[model samples]
Target: MARDDRAVGVSSFEGQATSAGQASLAGEATGTASASGPHFAAGPPAETGEPLRHPPHGEGDERAGEVSAGGRGRPSRAPPSLSWLLFSRLVFPGIFLASGLAGLLTLREIVAPPLDMPRILSGLERGGSARAEALTQVHEAILDPRYRDLKADPELAESLIRVLETELRQPITGSPEFTVAYRAQLCRLVRELDTPRTVPVLLIAVECRIADTPQLDSPIRRAAAEGVVTALERHGPDCVRSVPGGVAALCRAAKDPVAPVRAAAAAALGHIGGDEVCDLLREMLHDDTDVVRYNAAIALAYAGRGTGLDTLHEFLRSENVRNLADTGSTESVIGDRTCKLLCRALFALDRLCDRSTEERLAVLHPAMEDLCLSRAPEEVRTLAMRVDLKIERFHR
Candidate 1:
């Protein structure tokens, strides 16, 4: 189970070899015993007009997987007629070429940057379907076979993370809009993967991006910062571990000036735990932002840290502890936060019940009940219910 916890990541650098010898396979594409290379004849004895010879009944395929005199599976791979090199070897990788072109076009379209939306109900309704479509295309171009290949191989997930970090850290030069847009798109794709094996790769990629997140106020930087928190929020503890300096980076980012980013950081730290992570979370308990403090309580409980439950206690009593699911925009940071708030609380209760003690749950019962009663989404309510089940199981 412990082994099952640490997940895989992604990479495209050392993906399938690009030098695929594209032989102009002109042979008979046969499914018979006499099929040969691209140039070979299909039927038996194209020259011999006699009856077909047999190797005796029950004597088929004497050399399974091995090449026979007829060059069965070996040389018959291709007649070697149609340019057995990477589209004539002159043009190495077509995918990378395509990616480069697509990337350029994407940059061309990224002329304008997104404007800031104040935390208003109306603003939250403004959406980004166009940007989302553009981002999806970019993710495919950047990830594609690389992401697919990495998901299939657990052995290479660690190295994939390393390569991604190295790649993201390289000198990023482009139009301000393009640079941020590209990085943000890549960062967002980190969670698009389904396999647990890709977790490490996604985790490190996000951390390195956050570490690379510039201190200045740019949309790209904000995106990077938000991406880190988003990933942690999405994957939780699965995103923890294996990242070299991830804890330190999150600890630092927890103090980010951006409220959403700071809340995200606090939320993420709970998924991963250590003496250092605990210390940072404890400190965040006193953070000026109510969002940060609220997230810190959940994280601390998830980490099984017996912290002073002051924030959670107060939060449970606050009237604003309910869901704000009315946000219609996917891009509004305020909407994102508002909607996720109750969900985050529900998620925390579930984690705490799964990983904490009966003693902790006793103190948590009131707040947990309040969260469970809140009109959260279906999944969030389910999470809250699961905690109740866990508590009952513990008592039994």
Candidate 2:
């Protein structure tokens, strides 16, 4: 019986090895065995034969037991646990399936594309119902902060602005929240997209001063003004328009007690200058504050027309007299800025003047020489050289 038991154990070990090898071959072909095969190293046999009893004990029973145990050792096999099988077959496959499904969903969204109002609006009327609906979708998207990140997408930004314009046209009581949210979204879009569409909306927002409530005025108005300035700076003359009340507000801002408001207005006027801008700048040239006058001179240089040259020349001569009177010891930076402004104004005037080449050269030569040779700031020298070169080229 002992010999039979030993033979059976050896046969069981051989059978197990053969089964493992076959399973490995199948796994290599199907790819499933790679993860599961390692676990079978300690797997139990497919069948457990009847238990074998030990030989009867005698005087040398201890020695005999040791010999028998050593000669016919059974292979160690760990019992298969349901938990391990479930993890191997069910849990891992579930994770892979979930990841694949997620990828598919993402691909679907990308291929189908989202609604893009800016592109749609390119072919639709600004005030039409189609545009309004598109804008509404954008407005809804932006009201959530998550859409803020989406602003990086140009199409999304365009849609948001279209919606914002529609909201602006509605009555104030219609949905103040929507109006305010739309303006906020417009502000973000202008800063993010900095496109032409944002320009008109920014101007309208500034002109409307939508934040009538005291609590809302300071932050919202400041942001709107900044947006308008940014739009103009980025897009230049094309984005500028001469709204009836727009110039008036800017003109008032030029004289505002607050220096920043005044500066912003001066910059805006320079950006959108016309006959009206020239007039406003001329009046401000005589302002009580030298700072205001200095800015006015700069604006005049930027917005100047044919007569603008003569007016700036007079200011330059007046500033020269003022500088001489002070003996150049004044701490007021405005005086220095005024001198620079005068130099620029002279340059701008030289560009627009229709005098003979000789006459233009004679008029501009002194200022050009002073700008180059004197300790004038680099900007002044640069502008002077640019003007001089332009004049030379024009004559050529």
Candidate 3:
């Protein structure tokens, strides 16, 4: 998945090479083949069958009436022509060999080696599409075992975070969409690094607002918030709390005007246990956006707070959630997101139910039973049944 995304991200570079290189190669091959092809090489001149005659310099000039041994005046066959030999043995083979090598090299350029990390990090600091391209390579590198330890590179992670901060403040000089995408991708990289040092910067990114462009601001902030969630998951909330203003930053982001940013903040807060975080998440339960509310509920459950039980009950009844499980298409982005959110909710509920009183477990019974018996997708039904079993065990 990362590789496919990186391919798309760097498609501009590949598209340019494809047009120029492949077109030139096509023309070159056509010109060479046509020049040597039978159509271009004229056939021998037609035989008139007349004796060859020339002005006789003298009466006995033997060259005056020259003819072939058959007396048909045909030119005697001679050794193969030099041009033919070169075209047949050298040029023809050379054309194919050159074409093969050219094609191989073109493919090599399109699928170039992963740029070295230092070079990639340098390009990222340079900004613009170079930064976008560099981020793509870094994403691919993270998946590569050779660069898997990238998460541990404290210096590199800090440098990238600084670049991210500087780039976010700069005016949009290129396609705004491209700018937003790279900024989001940069946040994703910080998330991948799983370094606690980036917690402070990630917090700053979540609240950093781009002027007059909610379209741009929302995605970047959402990505930054997700980065915070990833850090908490890896190193725990203590790492974030240690950073001055980190928890406060998240609290502010939980109320971001953008629903996705709010949703991401709820997810991050779920990993932390505290009255403040729970209060914030509980407040978020009333958010207008369905995803925001759902995320807030799931987060509260993660903190072992049952304040989100009603929200989870509501989530189980949502038409969108029910349909998401039944959809046959695997590529639907909404479907994937819904599935993940549903899975998280079920897992959170299952854990939460384990600690609930018998009466509390009874509150969840109807939703769990209905989900298990319904035509929800197999995975959803399976998880719902697990929740039922957990509830049943308490009764037993």
Stretches > 4 Å off in candidate 2:
1-153, 159-192, 204-230, 233-238, 242-252, 255-257, 306-367, 374-380, 389-396
Which ten residues in a row are the worst by lDDT in model 3? 36-45
User: Distance from true position, residue 83, model 3, in Å?
Assistant: 56
Q: Highest TM-score, which number?
A: 3
- Against the true structure, whose lDDT is highest? 3
Please tell me which model should have the higher TM-score, number 1 or number 3: 3
| Candidate 3: C-alpha RMSD after superposition | 28.8
Steric clash pairs (candidate 3) = none
Backbone clash numbers for all candidates listed: 7, 1, 0
Question: Model 3's lDDT to the true fold?
Answer: 0.79
lDDT values for all models: 0.55, 0.58, 0.79
Put down candidate 3 lDDT per residue, 240-291, tens digits, no spaces: 8898888888899888888898999999988876998898899999999999
lDDT of 2 by residue, 178-268 (tens): 6566556555545555466666565565544454563443333445555666667677755656444555666665665545445556656
Worst 10 residues of 2 by lDDT: 37-46
How do the residues 1-396 of candidate 1 rate in per-residue lDDT, one tens digit apiece? Answer: 554443321223223222121121323244333233223435567455767787876466455435566566643353554565646554557767888999987775654333222321122133245444443443554355433543333333333344345546666555545655555555455444444544444444434433344432234334444555555656665555556666666677677666656766777777777888888889888988787788888778767765836676666555454433222332556546655665666566666666656464565565556545655455655666676677667766
lDDT winner, 1 or 2: 2
